[model samples]
Target: MRIGLLTEGGYPYAAGEPGLWCERLVRGLGQHQFDLYAVGGSGIPRPLPPNARVARTADLGGSDSGPTARNLLERTAFGDRRAARRAYGRRERRRFVEALHRLAVGVCGEHTAGTGEAETGAELGIAFAEGLYALAELARERGGLPGALRSDDAVRTLESACRAPGARRGAAAAGLPDHLAFVEHLERTLRPLSLDWYAEDALGAADLCHAAAGGTTALPGLLAKRFFGTPLLVTEYGVQLRSHYLSAAGADRSAPLRTLLAALHGRLAAEVYGQAALLTPGNAHTRRWQEKCGADRARIRTVHPGMAADRFAEVGEDEESGDPATLVWVGRVEPAKDLIALLHAFAEIRALQPDARLRIVAVPVRDPGSGAYLAHIKGLAAQLFPDEAAGAHAVGENPVTFEELGGPEAPTLEDTYASGAVVVLSSVVEGFPTSLVEAMFCARATVSTDVGAVVEIIGGTGLVVPPRNPRALADACLALLREPERRHRLGAAARARALELFTVEQNLAAFRGIYLELLSHAPVRHRPGDGVPFAHPAEAHVPGSWAPKAAAGTGAPDA
Candidate 1:
């Protein structure tokens, strides 16, 4: 079956996020065809992954515009249902306005779990948002609407509603400033609905549309289901809701602005989750976020992102000599990785195993975060070992080697893994920690901090330590370093587990089954003027069982 793989800022971009996984899936399942849809700027110049082939690529980076073209962005006047007058009624508008007021300006009503009622102002705000989207969709179908949906009238209506006498306590306190902030944010947030890609000609052809990520990537999926009857599957490796909340936690926007944006995103998540046929999260953490965003538990599945399994065969062989003393830290040099802690831990390691070498590999990116962190770590290394260095230790000659995985010394990622006795991921914050998994594929015992899905992914294959505890990290590394037999044993076990669960073969097999299962159950709906359908389209006129049997028996002249 054909799959419409939708993505944003990645996939088929030559340098897209989930680039390798997409390629792996495509290559692994050669029987199925894939169409890649990516949205990002045009700076991507990397070569495609070996397995990922695209029948066609739909780019959403830049738009071609002329003077007469509509900008697609317009003012939103909440309660302006003039464009879609009938979607909302008197009672809905009143309830929505009251709830929105409580949500925006007042203390949000209590969100009493399991009850559909909006006891808190927050719940009320979300209710009001539902009315707004409902009205917008109605307007799109009917070609116009006002009040809680779209238009200058809706904005005016929203302003009046928030300022209404019976509104929630906080909403009743809203001024022109609060009103304007909400309106400004509303315009920016609702930009997804204004795109033309939602039409029949764009997203209708696919048997199923699978969004590789959420947020903007899922926007087209929403449209496809709206304009066409296309089914949608939204998979998020990192919960977009959590990211938004973190990003907006300390913004300069007003309380109402924050509330409105939150409500809008909350409402969007709700809508996406509700509309999606399936919701796949990469880890349990992200899965919980999906549930909190109102995703039905039955519809949610945890599909760990696939990683390359073939690259590690050499080191993973039954007989390979990997150092028990040498520790490898591979990833872009960022503060989040807590390299300082790693250095301090390395100092502890040096006290016991004097010859133990700690290699800090950097993956080149345009950002100076890597270079700056490398320099800072180099300075710390100097401070740590003040006795050694002068003409003896230059940049390249230092014991704490600052090598790039995609550059000289360790030319490739696989080579870097092969060089290390053990892989160390000392990250304080991580989403999926792909490098750790890659190391696992190479049959290298890892020492990742107890962050993200490290503990879950490790599953007793490698040693894990708490974040920012250099001493504890040192102890764990020392334990593995001291026991060469244990390291080899753990490495073998980790390699076995990675191949069983995290490979492209397993991912492809699971998805291939799901695709067939979804299609088999879904009734085939043929678009008008699309030629003869494979399904039986002929009308029936049978009087009884005997008549039907008689008709079925004769194909020539009318019996």
Candidate 2:
């Protein structure tokens, strides 16, 4: 069976989040053909698996489509236009306006009648779905939705919807500029409507459309399902809506824009979840988010993100190694990781155990802001350990050492995890805690703040404390450091759990079954020359009682 693997800012790119996993899946299932549809990346060179090939790639991040002439006659033509397109008809224009209004109302907040009778949440959901499809259908027919969505009419419609009674206060207070900005952003976000991937020769030809992430990536699958009856299987290792929320929370945008974008994302997420044939959340933490966003519990499955466990196999098997008094933190150094709090906790740990050491093994994230955050963390470390040297030093000399992953002391990821007895995660905000899981794979006892899926991933195998609690974090690390036996036990348990649930093999197996399961239930779209049943069919040639019988004197099978 052919699978359309859809991705956004990931996959088929060496630096993408799901690149490794997608590559692994495609390589492992060599029997199946995979067509990759990627969006928003450098299109940087990356090797493709033998069974997989690129179908189409679009740069949603502002790549030019080149110049084209716009003829007035073609632009003025109606639905029968063969060149450009006509403005929406009176009826179609009203339908489009009404749909957008309904969607906006659903997004901002539901309204009640003068009698206090309000539309049900289900009704609002219907409105959002209807509005989304209406716009999509309009784009299909008019061929100018990109411009239409960015027009003054769309902005005015959105503003009016926000000003309507029962709209959320934040949205109701939006200014003209906010509306204009939002409309422009919305047009880009909804660009999947203008894509030509829905034809029978494209995504329509696939047995199933597997979205690597939700939000933007899943939009194409939604369109595919809408246009060609293709089933959509959405897999989200890190929930896209949640990431948007975090980024919006941190962004220097206006309140109105934030509120409007949040509402839009909420409505879109609900629609996607409602339409998906199945929703696979990488962890239970993400599953809860999906459930809250209206994904049916029956359709939700927890598929843990797979990691290559073999790289850490030797480290995990060596139970007696690692410094008993050292605490390690390994990950990208960013403010979200809350290294400041980690430094504070380490200060407390040092006071309790004079010989205890902390190794902050980290690498900067792609964002330039992380460099400043890393410097701040370094300054905090200096102030916390004022007696220690101000700069880098040989390993084991400084009580608190800051180093990158590829430094002489830690040449590889496995080596970095092996450098300490207790791995620590002190982030106040987290999603799946990939670093914690890596620690587990290294068979290292973890002392992590309870955030995101850390508790779920640890599964009682390691210590979990409340986020931003320095005393708790310090105490947990101290306990693990003081008691070697408990640390060893937790490490062994964590390793077992990681191997059982979070390995590449497990992930491949899950997707392998999911692909077959979705395909088994999907409606088969028969094409030309498929042949009639039992007429020169391969099944008829099988050695079974139902096989065609041979004539008494002839060697050939009777028809």
Candidate 3:
């Protein structure tokens, strides 16, 4: 079978998100051929397994134009020509206008009224889907949507919809600049309409289209399914819509613009969830989000992300290795981790057990603000532990040590986990909690805040505390520190659970079955010149119900 693997800012790039898992999947399923279609990020290719190869790669992250000839080709194909603009007939124009109006109404309505307004949300969702498909059809028929979507007509349509009665107050307040900015962003997000991947020679040739994530990455697969009847398998480790909400929450954008963008993303997410044959969320937390966004419960499956457990095997088996009085926190240093709360909790724990140590081993994040956040955390640590030498750690001298993952003290991930008896997760916000699972794989007892999937993953194997509560967090840590027998019991249970459900082999097995099951039920849409089914001599004699049976009197099969 041939698979078209689609991704945005992930896979086939060394620095890509979820790159390792994707690589593992491809390498594990060597029997199947894979054609990768990637968008955004540095287009540098990674070393792929022999069965996998790059089919198409595009960088849509910026506004830079490529070669003149390519630009001309795009302009011509996308109906940038004045003659082509004139070719948009009265009927086509009306359809385009109606589509935009419906979409804008949906966006604006939902923003003013909440999603709990079921009648409005449902009506708006239907309108949004209809408008989206109509636009897709128009783009397909008219060559491209760039010219139409960017035209003054589109902006006017948006403005009129925003100002219309029953529209959200925030949307109605949008100025001309806000409308223009939104239109530009929408065009870029919908750029898949102008891409050539939907052609018969491209995505149409694949047996199945597997989207590694949602949002723009799934856009191509959506188009392929629309045009070619190809089945789409969407797997989301993190909900893109939720990420957008968080990002927009922190962005310095106008209220109207933010509301408009949120509505657009929400509608798009609904459409994607509605169309997908199967929705595999990395955890139940994402599954619930998808359900709220309109994904069918029947189609949703929870596939826990696979992690390599071999590296932590030795530590897991040791049982009595790490210091009994130490607690460790591992992950990227970010505000969401709530390291400040962890410090306060540790201060409380210090009062109870003066000999107890806390180790905060973090990997530096790529965000520019992370440096400042790290400095803030270090300052908090110093203020809390006034007497200890916190700079360069001298092992037992400092009660709290802040170290990087690859530093001389903590050379590797396993080393960090192995240094402490209890792994602590102090995150106020989390998704799947990969570090918590890693600690589980290391056979360490855990104390994590009740955020995201922490409770779901822990499943009574470890202690859970409420987010933003230092006292609760401190109490949980104290429980694990005071009772060695309890820690051992939880650690053993945690490791057993990790081995049973979260290994690479289990993930590969699940996907292998899903691919075969999807392909078996899908209708065959063979391309021209493909070889006849069962043409080989050996294949002709294979045992199956379809094979002809021999008559009782003769060796020859019945005609």
Candidate 4:
């Protein structure tokens, strides 16, 4: 099978969870050929597997007239520099405006007041999808939308939509600057519409389109399905709409601008969910988000993110290893981790058990603020528990020790998990809780805050406490620490569960089956002069069981 793997910002080009997961999926499914379509990736992509190759990439960074725009035209315009000079005629400009106007109206939250939510949602969904596909068709015919989206007409359309009656209160307050900002953002978000990858030679040839995420990353997949009838399989570990909300909360944008952008993403997410053949969420928590966003319950499946268990196998089997008095917290140090609360909880733990130690091992994170957050966490630790050890030989070092994963003290992930009896996760916010899963793989007892998929992933194998509750967190950790047999039992059960559900093998198996299932139901797509193995069998044309027998006996050719 030929798979079109669509990704954005990461995958192949950047090193992150999305990239790592895509790389692993491509590598694991070596039997199938993969064509990677990436957007806005930086740095040299890691080595491609033998069965995979980068088919196309679009850089969404920089402004409309910047180098990136020129590069996009050069690459997607089939090497025709004259394509950049191609402008929409009067009629073409009108078509573009109409399509864009519908899109703006769809996203600007204009609906009949007092209407039921279901009716309003259905109306908005239809409008959004109609406008979205119309714009796609326009872009496909015009070669690209970068120029058109940056035109004055596009800004006018958006401004009119925002100021229209019944539009969102926030959107109605948008000014000229807000319109310009939204136009710029929309251009980048819809950049995939202009990519030439939808031709018969590119995504059109794929047996299945696997989107690495939702939102803008899935735009290519959506187009492929729309243009070529290729089935789209959308997998999201971190919900893109959720990320958009979190990012908008932190951005310095104006209220009207943020509202407009949020509406755009929300409508896009709903469209993507509605159109996808299957939506694979990494956990139940993500599955719920998909369902809430209009994804069909029957089409939704929960596929847990896979992890390599071999790295921690030895530590898991040998339960006797690690300090019984030590607690380990492993993951990127950030505000979301709520390390301050963990420090306070640890203080309580220290008062009860003076020998109980906390080994806070920081892993690498992409955020620039991580360094500052780690420094802040260190400062708090110092203030909370002043080191009584003035000399090197003082009874034992402070109960809390901060170390990086690759440092001499920690050395490796396996060693870090093996160095503690109870693994702790204090994240007030989380996604799939990769670190907790790793701890489970190491067969270590865990006490995780109730966030993200913690409760679902733990499944009663480990102790769970409400997030940001220092007393509750401390109590759970202490309970596990005091009962050696209970900790060992829970650790063993966790290891069993992780091996069964969270291993790389299980993840690959689930996708392998899902790929075949989706392809089996999809119609065979063939292009002119393309030799597609069984494009149209005799049964497809003749119908019924007798057709196969008749063809066999008469030596008749397939239709």
Candidate 5:
């Protein structure tokens, strides 16, 4: 089957979040034909996988690009729907407006488990909520949606939702800056609605539209079903909705804005689950989130993100040979990764074992904000370990060294893993925990803060610590440091588990079956003798809709 694989910021791009996984999927499933459609993150060069035949690509532009919407006329050749929408009488317009209103104001975010729609038959409510909006897209705009979805209406909803009881903590966003931001964000969030991606040429041709992440990516999938009776498979390794909540929590953005955006995302997720043929969350953690989002338990499948095993093959086998005194922390040096906390923990580890030195080897993903954060961590290291500055070996002998991967000093990933007795993660927020998996591949014992998917990924093979607590993090690292035999045992077990469950082979096999499974029960749309796809039925045409019968036979009915 030909697959139109949709992606945002991960695949086909030289640098994307799910790039490796998508590349692996394409390469592994050589039998399938794939037309990759990419939406690239700003400034990042996207490289297509060798197996994928790229159809189209769009730049999400930048963080500052104003709100976007897909204009229907520009995207579709819906011969009759345009007129049908314009001719919608009063009743049609009212129903459409009501659905749009409820959708915009629904109180939920990515984290809100959907109202238990399955047991309660709440899919109807979700359908009513989702269908109304989709129908509105096809619904006669009679007088053009009665002014709903306008800036003024948006302003009012923003006002009401923000002031409503149980508002988010950021509720104080009542000022001008806040209001404008809301308008800006709302438009961008709704951009997918305006796209013609749902049309047969874009998203409809595929057997299933699989969105790599939620939020913007799911929009086209929604439209695909609306236009072509296509099924959708949404796979979210890092819950987009949860990320929104976390980002909003610390954001200085506005309370009303957060509330409104959260509601919008929540409703969209519900609508997605309400309509999707299947939902695959990367792990049980994401699975639970989908279930709570009102997805049918039956439809929810836990498909672990596929990680290439090659990176870890060498590290996995030689688990016992890495340095006993050096503890390696490899990843981007971001504030969230909490390297500062790791540094302090290392200071304490030094107290326990004077020979122990913490080597922070930065893995450069080359993000926009990486420079400043890396610089901040470097400065923090200087203040904490002043003796390591340039040429000063002070009283305590600066025991921590900051370095970057792919540099002169640090060797390859295998070499980096070999140089450490333990791998460490100190992030306060994480998702699906890629670093932990990498460490596990190298069969390196790890001490990580119990955050995000650390515990989930580590399972039982490594020591876990509570986040932000330097003391606990220190204790965990030392436990591994003093007991070499224990580290070796845990490392060996971790490698075996990772190879068995997290490889590209397993991921492809799971999806290969899922694709067939979804296709098995899905309704076949094409009809023989219909000619080109989606051609209007002969009876439904207004006599000579396609051609003049006389030029062939009648000529515009003598008009």
Candidate 6:
């Protein structure tokens, strides 16, 4: 089957977790044809799988020089730029204003007091849908949405909605700066409407549209389902709305601005969840988030992230556990990882087991703040273990060592996981905990803080403690360190569970079924002169069932 795969900042253009998983998915599902619609990223895309090709790519930076509608029109025999511009004149302007007004109002309004939340929510949803589709249609016709959305008129309409009676208090209090900020964000969010992929030869021609993530990436799939009869399958490893909230929480923006933006995202998420044919969240954690944001439980499925376990096979299968007294932590060095707490926890562990060592192995820093955070961690380590600080220069006598993944000490992930007896995760905020899964793949026992999907991923195979609690984290680590037999049993179980559920083969099998299941229920779409296999089956022309008729002499009833 032909699949329209929608993605953003991942897939062909970027090299990261997002791109890796997508590449694996494409390579594994070689039976299906994939047409990728990638958004944003500059460097060369990785080589495409045999069955996959990039259908279109858009820059999220909004650098499109020609609108899709105008370009398509100009290519026609009688089409001209002047005529296209005239098409977006007075009448089109009125339509755009009306649609934008309705959308802004829907986004700005709050639930009524007397009316049940369900009723008011449904009404707002309807309003939002009407405005969103009307705008999409206008973009298809005039291709002026990108320009008009950035115009003064759009800001005025949004302001009027915010100031209207019964608007949410935060929205009513929005200042000029907030209005400008929101308009810019809104333009970027709705930019997908202005793309040329909505035509019959693009998203409309696909057997199914698969959105690789939620939020802006899903906009095209939403439009495809609206404009054509294409079914949309939305898969979200990370909840986009949750990410928006986290980023906004850290921003220096006003409460009113944050409130307005939150409402916009919440409304959009609700729409996407409501319309999706099926919602596949990477884990139960994301499934709950989707449900809270209005996804139907019946339509939701949990699919774990897939990992390549072959690289760690030797480590996992090895019966000998490395240094029984060593505890290792591996991941990126970020504030969220709470390495400070880990350091404190290790201090307690050190007091109990002086000979015990800790390896603080980190991947290369990605965020600008990470380098500073890593430096702070190193400083704290020095302060806690002053004697060890000096011993580091003398020899490898330091109880705590900080090293990068590919450095001299730890040349690879397998070496990092194999070098320690127990794996530790002290993250205060985690999603899926890829490092913990990596430890499991290496057949290493883990002691992780209870955050995000830690408990779920561990599945009773390892110990989990409360986040930010040094005592608890330390105690859990000690329990595993003291019991060699228990650690061996848990590590063996972890490797078995990882192989059963988290391998790439398992992930590919799940999606292969999901794709066929979605297609099976979708209405068959056949166009004229198409080279479809059974487009005009002989039995389809008959009104009744294709049962054999009784013999003419028998006068029997038709079977």
Please count the clashing residue pairs in each candidate, in the order shown: 34, 0, 0, 0, 21, 0
Candidate 6 local lDDT, 272-338, one digit each (tens)? 9999999999999899999998899999999898999999999999959589999999999988899
Q: Write the per-residue lDDT of candidate 4 for residues 112-222, one digit (tens) a residue.
A: 657586797688778778889999998899788757776667777888888887688999999876776677678889988988898988998888899989999999999
Judged by lDDT against the true structure, how good is candidate 2?
0.79
- How well is each residue in 28-96 modelled by candidate 3, as lDDT tens digits? 987787998877646568888888988887776643122233443444345444443585887888888
Q: What is the lDDT of residue 31 in candidate 2?
A: 67
Give the lDDT ranking, best first. 4, 6, 3, 2, 5, 1
lDDT over C-alpha atoms for residue 112 of model 3? 34
Q: On a 0 to 1 TM-score scale, where does candidate 5 land against the true structure?
A: 0.79
List the global CA lDDT of all models. 0.67, 0.79, 0.82, 0.85, 0.68, 0.84
Candidate 1 local lDDT, 319-372, one digit each (tens): 366555689988878788899999999999988887788888887777754577
Global lDDT of model 1: 0.67
- Model 5 lDDT tens row, 1-559: 5566778673565454487777778788765667776655334444545546766565654352332222222212242235434555557645544554454334321222466534333533453366446543743223333223333434455556455553444544455455545545655565555444554566666767777777777766776777677778888898888877876233665455556566666766777776888888888878777788778998888888888779668667875677798888888766788887887887788777878888888887756787888788778777776766655655555567777788876868778887888998899988787878888888999888887767778889998878999999889888888898999999988888888888778889998888778776778666433244433321233433454332345332221
Residue 488, model 5: Cα distance from true site in angstroms:
1.0
In order, what is each prediction's RMSD in angstroms?
A: 7.9, 5.9, 5.7, 5.5, 9.3, 7.3
Q: Candidate 3 vs candidate 6: which has greater lDDT?
A: 6
Work out the TM-score per prediction.
0.76, 0.87, 0.88, 0.90, 0.79, 0.90
Worst 10 residues of 5 by lDDT: 68-77
Poorly placed runs, candidate 5 (over 4 Å): 40-51, 62-99, 107-132, 135-179, 248-250, 365-369, 388-398, 527-559
Question: What ranges in model 1 sit over 4 Å off?
Answer: 27-35, 41-132, 135-188, 248-260, 368-370, 389-397, 535-559
Q: After superposition, how far is residue 170 of candidate 1 from its true place, in Å?
A: 9.2
Q: Which structure is stronger by lDDT: 1 or 6?
A: 6
